[model samples]
Structure formats: C-alpha cells, structure tokens
Target: MPLWFDSHCHFDFAEFDQNRQSEWQFARRVGVSGLLIPGVTHARNLQLEALCQQYSWSFALGLHPYFLAEHEQMHFEWLDVALESSLACAVGECGLDRVLAVDDAHWQQQLACFSTHIQLAKRHKLPLILHIRGCHDEAAAMLRRARFEYGGVVHAFSGSEQQGKAWLDLGFCLGIGGAMSHPGAQKLRRTIAALPKTAWLLETDAPDMKPAFWRGPANSPAAIPLLAAMLAQLQGAELNELSAQLERNRQSVLPASYLIREEPSIN
Candidate 1:
C-alpha cells in the first residue's frame, strides 16, 4: 500500500474525542503514516501538544482568525511563548478571513495578528499553515512584505490559478483536500490540475471537509486515500506515484525535525 502524510488535520477536535485512538489506528492501517494537527487558539496549545506527543503526530500553533474575538494581545505573547517552547512544526492556522463582515478595527486586528505569526514563524525558523478564505490577495500582500524564509502551505486552498501561483512564488504549497472531490468544484479542480506537481500537498482537514461520498459524515484521516484517488484522477497520475510525490513536496516545505519517520518494516 502507498504511504500518505496528511499535511493538515484537526485530530484534536471534539469530534474525535471519543474515538481518537481507534481513528489513529484505522488511519495507520489504511496507509496514513503521518498527520499534522494545527492549533486554533492559545487555550488549545497544551491539548494539541499532548495529542501530538501521544500519537507521534506533528503540529502547528497559532490563533485562528475566526476566533479573533476570543483572542487578545496577550494571546499573541502566549503564542510566541508556545512556539519558543513547544515542539510545534509551524506557526499558523492563522490568516485573514473576509467572509465575516466586521468593522475596520477587527479587520486590522486580524492583519496585525497574521503579521505577528509571520514574524514568529521566521524567528522560530518554522513554516506556516495558513487558513485563508476570500482574502488571498490580502494574505499574499502581507506574505510578500514579510518575505518569510521558511515555506508553508495554504491549508484547504480554494483560489484562482494566479493566486495559487502567487503563493507558490512565495515558497508555499497548496493544501488539496476533500473539496477537490466535489463535482461542483470545477474551478478549484482546474486550478489544481494546472499547477505543477511539486506545488501540491494532500490534506483531509478532517471532521470538516468530508469527501463527496461521505457528505454530512465526520471526515477522518482514513479518508485520505479517497481524496488522494480524486486528486490523482485530476492530476492524471497513478495513485501511488501522486502519493509519493506529495510526501516529498510536504517534506520540502515543513520543518524536518517535526516530521515523524515511519517505523521499519518487520521481516
């Protein structure tokens, strides 16, 4: 079976609270050898850390934009401390979100928070795991100004081809997920198909973006192969070949120390 690295997932979410262990085992049995869990808030860092340690999974720490109201200036300080001390693989799950109609003050706050995350990622020499939605241009502009040295992925990226290329030029990879399997997502599919092979990373963004067949069901890392198959069909490559190439792409962008190596096969 082909091995997979789910570059982005929220295994820490409450949806998996009851069956996390079984979920992990099922994912591993189905060829998902690695998983990256990203923190959404300061309060969740310790929990995320404990999960990563328990499962040997990698993770990123940041303040998500959707929860901006719940965050404060002190949370930024807390994030900095977390990045400095924890074994986090990156600094994010942070970025802009225009979907929410907020006043200028809130928007500016989001921008400032995102900028701080970029600085933290740079200082720690780790990549970023951005969560951008309808603010690709704004996020791109911020990234260009920061000129972050370490690369990262735009998790669950759904943007124009130009936007995707802009991120790639900024040394970022596009996280492809269950959305690619949706027949109505023609534009996203076309954009991904046109992008270079090295520009893509596989992610389930589980318990959220479940595949078309499993719509309304909680997504899991075990569904990675299903997403992979759809992506392979789009890319016109064999499933195993696409899986291997995506793993290489993931390694190139993410922090090497945080990556969990697969155990040796028994005779």
Candidate 2:
C-alpha cells in the first residue's frame, strides 16, 4: 500500500497519553507513515517538541486563536525563540475565528496574533498551517496583504468554492478531514468535487473531527486511510492514486525540511 501522511493531528494531546505507543503502531500498520503535530499555545511547545522528536514526527509551532485568554505578547517572543531553536516544519495551527472572537477587540486581537504568525513564518521561510473558521475571506485578505511566500495547508477546510479558490490563489492547500464524510456536508462535498485533486491534503486532526463511522469517539491517526477513502470517493479517483496526489500536494505546500523520518524504537 502507498504510504500516507496525516498532515494535521494533535498526537501530543493528553488523550493519547495512556495508549500512544499502541496508537502509533496502529497508525503505522494502517499505512500512516507520518503525522504533523501543530502546537496550539506557547506552553505546549516543549511537550509537542518532545513528542515529535521522540517519534521522528514533523511539527508546527504557533498560537491558536481559540486560546486568546491564555496567551500573551510574551508568547510570541517565546514562539520566535522556539522557531529558531526547534526543528519545526511550519508556523501554525494559527489563524482567525469569527465565532471564537466575539467582539471587535477580540477579532482585532485574532488578526494581530495571526499577522504575527504570518510574519514569523515569512521570517523563518516556513509554510503556515492555518486554522480558519468563519473567517476565510478575512484570513485571505490578511494573507494577500502579507504577500507570504512559503505556502501552507488550511486545516479542516469547509468553505465555498470561491473561498477555496481564494486560499488556493494565495498558494495554500486545503486539509480535508472527517467533515467531508458527513452526508449533511453536501456543500463542502460539492466544493471538493469541483476543485482539482491538487488542492487537497489529507488529515485526521485527531482527538477531534471524528469520522462518520467513529463519531462520538476520540479520533486517531489510524483513521486517516478512511478519511482518504472518503475524499477519493468524492473526487472519483482510486484510493492509491488520490493518496499519491495528496502526498505530492503536501510536499508542495509544506517546507521540504518537514519530511518524515523513521521513528525511533520504543524500547
């Protein structure tokens, strides 16, 4: 079977603490060769780094928008330091959220935080892993203003065709997850069908975005193949063919240095 990559997953989260070893094994057995673990806050950088280093997995370091209450300007300073010292692949799991930021001040804060991450990614010459929710146009405008060079993936994409094209024009790939598997997600499914195959990158966003079959349960990287299958069905392509194309898409957007390495033995 062709190897698969979970371009976004929170394997560092405590949900995997008790069974991480078996989880990794299950992922490997299911043809998941690699995973990208993106940090949501400055505080988790150490833990995220350690997990990636221990498993030879790739990672992205940035401050997520939802945790605004927990972050401070000093965190950006720490993010700058972390980027220089660590082997992170990109600069996010960061972006704006319309619902999350209720007021204008809060929305502005999200914009500022997102801009800082964009600048950091530009400075580091790394791709961004954006987490846009209900603010695709806003995020697209910011990206256009920044004129960012390094491309990235927009994780958990569920937007209109126009919105999808906007992000594509900015040189970003869309991360497809369990959302596409839902029958009720007809609009998103139509968007996926309308787009070219190169516009997508498969992800599980584990411990979240559970697939239709596994709804109500914590997700795992092992479910990536199922996600890929759903996407392939929607795109009218063979599983392996779509998998190969998605891998190429991932390589195109993410920094070359983010390539997966062999995992170290648990013992």
**Model 1 stretches with alpha carbons more than 4 Å out:** 257-267
TM-score for predicted model 1 compared with the true structure: 0.94
Worst 10 residues of 1 by lDDT: 258-267
Candidate 2, residue 21: lDDT: 82
lDDT top scorer: 2
Tens digits of per-residue lDDT for model 2, 1-267: 767889999988889899988888888877788889999987887678777888878999988888988888898998898898888989988998998977999998888899999999998888999999998998888888898978899999988999999888889999998888877999999999999999998888999998888753599999888888888888999998997898888788975534454553444
Give the clash total for candidate 2.
Answer: 0
For TM-score, the strongest prediction is 2
> Each candidate: how many clashes?
0, 0
